[model samples]
Target: MMNLQKKKLYTLLALVALFVILFICNMLLSPYHMRIINLVGINIALVVSLNLTNGFCGVFSLGHAGFMAVGAYVAAILSLPLVKKAIILPELPKWLGSVELSFLPSLIIGGLVAAICALIIGYPVLRLRGHYLAVATLGFLVVIQVVITQLQDFTRGARGINGLTQYTNTWWVWIFTCITIYVVWRIINSAYGRGMMAIREDDLAAEAMGVNLTKYRLLAFCVGAFFAGIGGALWAHLITVVTPLSFSYDRTFSLVVMSVIGGMSSITGGVVGASLMTLVPELLRNLEVGITVGGISIPPLYGISQIVLSVVLIIVIIVRPKGIVGSREFSWNLFKKKKWNTMNQMEN
Candidate 1:
């Protein structure tokens, strides 16, 4: 027990030190690069949330972008200054235009609204299984985009909401990313998580074993939506814009790709997947600008990022469909196990 406690303490200290180093780097890095760090954190939150539903519960939900849209709009509206709101949303209601909120409160409100939406949507949609659920959830995404386009007074129609404050710095994003990871990790290790896995294995058998399928499934969906909403709010604040197009099917597909590449069953995979996917596009940006080597100029390649990512994804699917991490977790307990074995051998 003492050794375990010591190990935990050391692990916590190491994590704090790592964060401190990263924070220093963030402060010193160029703004363009700093943005990438912020993006990495946001993507981690989004991927982990989606993993909770599709990965753990086997729900195949594809409407995460819709939930994110809800949070982004709500949080952006709440945080916008009264003057900016008046300027941007001239047709908005007087009450909405006049109100303003700080970042944390507005973000919470956005997440809560998304969770409520999931609760309502999940009741009916969760009844379906397999591809049917995927189609129903996808329909939700389409509905959200249409509503945003039509709600001119609230959303400024297709123009989108802009000039949002940059409240999503590395510190804020990193804090929330840690919180998201911790919460999801706790949920995955709990008895409820086991029940979710059981359902994924065989819903009928799980039901026979007295696992309330609806209750557990709804819980996973709502929790996933809640985090996805927060991620959306962070993204809006980070980029200072929220358009209906930003939350389209393509955005959801990107997230699904990240989760798939990371291995949905592993939380570490979410982090790993989000990091690699986010960086790959930026790293490939140079390919778009052409390169010169040994007095030879290579012409710029258009849309090379997409092609490269697609090829990489196809290869992964063909070679290792389970993803980079699959369902396994990385552990530091190897040292502990070795020590215990040595003690037992000595005693014997």
Candidate 2:
């Protein structure tokens, strides 16, 4: 028990340290680069949230982008300046046209709206397990896309909504990322999270052991949707635009790739995966080849980075199926002990 308490304390301190370092980096980085960091942070929230259902709960869900769209649209409608809407969307409802909120409140409202939608959808869809659930959720994604495309008055139809305020920055991103990581880590280490793992291991056994499978599964689904909603709102505010096509299968693929590459069961894996995937392509864009050893001047293809990453992910899965970190977490105990040893050696 005492050892468990020490472990918990050490984990908390490590998380604190990680946040401090991320905050400092955000403050020191240039605005342009900070935007990329913000993307990394948002993706971290998304991938980690998805892992709750897909990783810990062992449920395959491919429709997270639908929740994101719901949040983005809700937040966009609520947060758009009244004057801007008046000029752009004059035909909007009187209530929508009259109200405008700041960034933070808009994000919260968006998340809440998405959570409500998740509750409605999860109640019915969560009843289906495994492949049936995946197909149903995919259907939901298609339905959402169709609805968004058809909603001309509100969502601006196929042309999409524009002229949003870009209020998202490094500070906001890091703050939300910290909150997400803390909340998820705490939940996963709690009884509820443990019950989720039990269900994942064996639903029948878990049910026999008094674990409420349906309730816990639905809870994890809702929580995942909630964070995905927040990520969507942040993304919308950052880009200052919204298009139904943005949350399509391509987006879903990217999220899946990040989660799988990072390690499905590890939160730190998700963070690393998102960061590397998001930045690698951008970094590749700047690479230049001056000379070729074989007397052939070859410039890198624009999409080579993605192809390489795909190959790497495939190899990782085939060779080491458990992912780079497996279920291990980022903790301070290792670092603290190393530091203590180094100090003792120096003193001696």
TM-score of each: 0.93, 0.87
Candidate 1, residues 1-348, lDDT tens digits: the string is: 236566677769967996998778877899999899889999999998899899989999999999999999999999999889888998888787888999999999999999999999999999999999999999999998999999999999799999999998888898899899879877877878888989999999999999999999999999999998999999999999999998999889999999999888778778888999999999998889999999999899989988998999999878879778787654444455543221111110
Please state the error at residue 131 of candidate 2 in Å: 1.8
- Taken over the whole model, the C-alpha lDDT of each candidate is 0.88, 0.80
Question: Looking at model 1, which ten-residue stretch has the lowest summed lDDT?
Answer: 339-348
lDDT measured at residue 145 in model 1 versus the true structure, 0 to 100: 93
Listing every candidate in turn, what is its Cα RMSD in Å to the true structure after a full C-alpha superposition? 4.3, 5.5
Instruction: Write down the RMSD of candidate 1 (Cα, Å).
Output: 4.3
Error of 2 at 201 (Å): 0.9
Stretches off by above 4 angstroms in model 1 are: 1-3, 293-297, 334-348
lDDT of 2: 0.80
Candidate 2, residues 1-348: lDDT per residue as tens digits? 125577677767966887787778877888778788789888988988888878788777888898888889989988998888887777788988898988889899889888888888888998888889988888878888899899888888788889899988776777788788778777777888889889888999999999998899888888888888889999998998998987887777788778887777767777877887788766765553233558886675667766776787788888867766566666544465542221111110
Let me know the TM-score candidate 2 reaches against the reference structure: 0.87
